[model samples]
Target: MIETAILTPLEEELFALVNALEQFGFKKHKSLLGSLEIFEFHELNLLLALGGHGKTQFGVQSQYLLCQLPQVELLICAGAAGALSNELEIGDIVAATATVEHDYNLKFVNRPLPRFTGTPQVIDTLKQLPRTEWDFRLHFGLIASGDEDVVTVERGQELAYLTGCVAVAWEGVGGARSSQFAQKQYVELRGITDTANHCAAADFEVNLASAMFNLAKLIVRWQAAKDYCAV
Candidate 1:
């Protein structure tokens, strides 16, 4: 069984499987920091939680909570991202085989920070699933995760150039760091709903749902597989 975690309600709906929901709590920890909700489908276990922006502070906290579990296997993160590359279209999916912190790079100034990397296990798992040509395309590339919501085209391009990544999302870098410490295979998937240029006046909530809906299809499919295997 592979254990997974989603960071938001939008991500929860986007990646939930058809399993009974289980509630969990952090010991003496306030829910304001984060909550624990596990969903079980077939024999697979998933932990769904959220991470808010505060200089990756929430992520470090989440990692501490996950350490208490000591049984989580794989981590999958799904969220909305701003498209930085011209090759990506709105509502399209970008599956990350690897993730890096965009703001951590300082090689130009003689500072080198170790980048957290994910394994190929995610690609292998997706390959196990039946391949059907779907409406949205799945692109595997470098994803830059950070705090700021990219809202300018120039900023998007600059970040893309800095990280050499195609997409930008808010929380995956934190997830990547935590997952690395857990020695779990990490898979970060994202959907682009707006170009940085259009994000200035876009309805973020609506776009977030659109991305979640796109991920929901995969969730349902995984759930169906779980049910079938149980039979």
Candidate 2:
């Protein structure tokens, strides 16, 4: 049974994690989820998949994979996110203790917002390590996801104030929703690629590499710690 799966939104991110996970002697595997790489560590098997770049792509892919592979208990959607918090610097990690679809509004229908919670088992697994083990600070807080690539300080502030998210990104909510529908555990881990501001695009390009590296490094290091594996 495939106990856990890691989904990334971009090719660069996919490869960065692949490189980091290679140390565990992973090998390519085929499935309805398309081409995937599998690695086993701490008695937990992690299959990595690329969901491409958006809520639609991520939702469709995650649901399809979970439907196809019912054994997968935890689905982790990890990638880059913009920092909405001034304290969060580039390259820091944000393990979403909760996720909210900030742009989703059903107020016209008197419906509540679509909000998702992360698996505490996964969060505790990440928190198991001491701060010194993490080269960068690891933040556990809310992450707001939407279809928009957040680029304005006003929009960033609005989302943070509304959803109580420290970081923002696209696609993670898709995974969160999909996992909720499938009745599976979910976790979203993001790296700060830029501050949600007018310069977001330029800053993302400049910091993406290190952000990805740090993300990959954190996952690998987490497994290496062998403190917990909730697959």
Candidate 2's residue-wise lDDT over 1-231, tens digit each? 557888898877777767655544555454444554333343335677887799989998888888878999999998889999998999999999988888887755866567788988779878886667566789999999888988898999998888889999999989998999999999999989899899998987788777877877777667656534433
lDDT of 1 at 105: 51
Estimate the TM-score of every prediction.
0.75, 0.87
Q: Which portions of model 2 show Cα errors greater than 4 Å?
A: 23-44, 225-231
Displacement of residue 11 (Cα, Å) in model 1 is: 8.3
Query: Which regions in candidate 1 have their CA more than 4 angstroms from the true location?
Result: 9-44, 105-114, 127-133, 198-203, 222-231
Candidate 2, TM-score vs. the true structure?
Answer: 0.87
Writing each residue's lDDT as its tens digit, candidate 1 over 83-177 gives 88899887677887677677665655865444556567556555456648467766778888776778888898898887788888777777777
Number of backbone clashes in candidate 1: 0
